[model samples]
Target: MKNSKKLFRIMTMCLMIVMMMSVTVFAEGEATEYVPKLYSTAWALVPPVVAITLALITKEVYSSLFVGIAVGGIFYGGGNFERTITHVLNDGLIGVLSDPYNVGILIFLVILGAMVSLMNRAGGSAAFGRWAGQHIKTRVGAQITTIILGCLIFIDDYFNCLTVGSVMRPITDKHNVSRAKLAYLIDSTAAPICIIAPISSWAAAVTGFVPGEDGLSVFVQAIPFNFYALFTILMMLGLVLLKVDYGPMKLHEDNAKKGDIFTTGARPYAYNEDDGKKENTKGHVLDLLIPIFSLIVFCVIGMIYTGGFFSGESIVTAFSNADASVGLALGSFFALVVTILLYVLRKALTFKECMDCIPEGFKSMVPAIMILTFAWALKAMTDSLGAAPFVEGIMKGNAEALMNFLPAVIFLVGCFLAFATGTSWGTFGILIPIVVGVFSNDHQMMIIAISACMAGAVCGDHCSPISDTTIMASAGSQSDHVNHVSTQIPYAATVAVISCITYIIAGFTKSAAISLGFGLIAVLGTLAFIRSREKANGTYIE
Candidate 1:
């Protein structure tokens, strides 16, 4: 079965190459602006299609994405093969290594690793395990708790995803609640909440990318149009109440029932590692709390520092000059130093054990880093080749003619870009620039367009199995990424179908109150039904 899957991936990759080549020859004239205009829209669409087709058929995200990236690079950089290769090295690989944006992400991941390790090594994980083992007695309670945590952490998607997974995994595992379920809970909460929240990194990112006359006004105007984001949060609430596990997620539930489990953290959990000096039990709740609180506080301080609270510069100027990577690194280091001292003072583990734990924790993040690098590479190559411009031209130029169906069309387009690139941020970045450009000029259309961009990017990420949220969900759950993708796809599709309808109605009405009113009611009503059905079937009962 594995061999066949591998073969299928190879064949699909070959097909993508052929399609790209054909497009290069046929539409060579149009791409003169960028890379000789090798592939027309018709041709450009082939890579994502092929990538998705292969991922669905072969169930290999990494291979599928790499193939898509290669196709894009080859198509865009074909004339300058050596230069293209160099570009991938300099721009794709080293760019990720050197750029402030990419480096900041890496530092954040490392800090997250350190924090998780500190918690686990200090016996904070075990304490939670013991506490949850005693308190979270029922399946329904477990799922609900997972959802609640997801909702509570609305400050940022990265914070939400990593912290929720790290803290909850042990508790979820203790209750025999599948990791896949935990992953879904985390994944659903992260982007969905970030989109809806007035203050979040996602919102800030949008603000940064959008060229605007009034930052506050533009943001306020955009609230109504962010349909998918609002709808997805509704869907998450619905899923929590209903316990509807369909698609790949359903399989994960079944696997959990059969006791299929994988752990992807510290070596101490593996049971095979015999280096056991009896694990630390002195690590109290405060050991975890201190580091976590410190991390958060330091991050805020870092933000302030960057924003010029200390520097005497204007906040905007300071922020513009700040490097997120440096902030994350410094914050993490501070947290790590403080947390290590706590452990030493508490005797949670010896100094050596603490030291060993840090390296292991960082090592655990390797897969995530690799996935991010390749994902970014694919995004850079496509963006350089005018992918966003092409999509924007098509969508904006046709918005007036296709007024009623604009929501569904935009939603689908956002989904396509997210799925292809596996990064909602990237998809959001591309769409916002274009959508803001189109909508900022007109009041009526701006609300709808901006909202569509938000909804579309989020919807795409929610569905795309290749997306980082999906990957983190799978990784955190210890489920196969493909399995998680397959399971979550159906549920995502259902919500999207409903969301599209919501978008269409909202567009024509152009009344935030009306759109939100009817939309929330419809989503809640659907969730109630699903919950009732699940309870009746004994799938979930409170």
Candidate 2:
């Protein structure tokens, strides 16, 4: 409550100043209108910026996202108090909640939460952790195992975040790895891995936006120039292997080794592993592995099913056409049913216990669900204001002007847009079309710029609190959402800055060999530099 009041006052003061500037400009009749004007101006970008800044400062997410939605409402309402309230309620909150696709995602999150709850209650998670501990040995091994598992689940970012976080969290925590660190690992792998994997949902999203062309072909080609995604992977390996920890991450990692997984006082998630369950002693690692394996297989089938694989489409075509949210929700629902039946048959969980987990899982997912709903609504607000078009106009306006440096510029634009909008798919959807126009999808620059777009969008989404993947990462690790966002930024930003430079190099070289080489060296070099400096100063947490 105190944090809410403090954030409210700050936002109100800023809004009042902005409102005054609008009024003075209106009187002159020379400035662009703010009241009903959105979708092609700088103002479309304000809501997320304000919200992200406040959340970072206040360490409160719900209020910060609401503030962002409110800003969007005010702009959409055009200075009418009553209209603002109506817009915020009708078009912002209810609008997103009522949408079928959004509702499907909510269902998936809740169901997955329940499944996880069931696993924990049945002692499957503990069993898996115990099993992992024997093989994993040290903290470094635990972190590397997390990375390896994350990289393997490259089908979908959403699936990756939730699944990896759920599976690896216990193991990582057992090894004294912090929840924040676990979240960063999960978040880093999701989009970064998805974007580079041609078989992933991210690749499909990229291809969907590029009509009348071999979208898949270009997507594959863009992989090498995808400096952000590739270099992010490089950075993660470097961080894990070299024992690199800096900034807020260092504090969390240090605390983790000292037995505090959360450096902060708040724990937003309620899932507990210590609940009394006779199954805990009886459950073996198979209890955990079987259910997880089923979920993945079912989810993949669900995607292809929606994409019409059964109806005649090829695997790649099916993947490209898959409705990920709907498919995932559908798949997870079936998976839940199957998992329940398995537990019941195995006597790992009583039917009543399985029934009990349904509510427990929903309860566990509430924090993530709430944040996701608000984040989606905020994105809806941005859309109402035409944020995508605003970004589109800018890309189109400067495409020719920034020719030689287009990849670098495009990468920066994608990063900022994705960060502001909190959706990589949307970021590239907007810019990709305009990019095709700029290069006519003709030159080598086309692939380079496209790669930059994909890379930067992932980087921004990785850092954004409002990003769905980021939200899932927080939920998966059961870390405080604010903590995950606050700690992930520096790490993601380090890679982003380096990727931007790589794009600049790619834009000119048009040679993956040279640019990619430069990126790898830069990333490894940066890690080496940090490791050396830490060693010299004896500031290394170890």
TM-score of each: 0.85, 0.94
Model 2 error, position 140 (Å): 0.8
Top candidate when judged by lDDT against the true structure = 2
Each model's lDDT comes to 0.67, 0.86
**Residues 1-542, model 2: lDDT tens digits:** 58766767877788766555444332224466444665568998899998898888878899889989889877876765666667789988899899988898899899998888888878888888888978999999998999999999999998999999989987898889999999999998899999999887888899999866799999998888888888888888899989998889999998999999998988987445444353466687877888899889989999999899999999999999999988899889898998899899998889998999899888888998999999998998898888887778777777888987988888888889889889999998898888877887466888888888898899889989999999999999999999999889998989888888888887777899998888888889999999999999998876
Which number leads on TM-score?
2
The 10-residue segment with the lowest total lDDT in model 1 = 266-275
For model 1, the local distance difference test gives: 0.67
Which stretches of candidate 2 lie above 4 Å from their native place? Answer: 1-35, 270-279
Model 1, TM vs. native: 0.85
Using alpha carbons, what is the TM-score of model 2?
0.94
Native-to-model Cα distance after best TM-score fit, residue 391 in candidate 1, in Å: 1.1
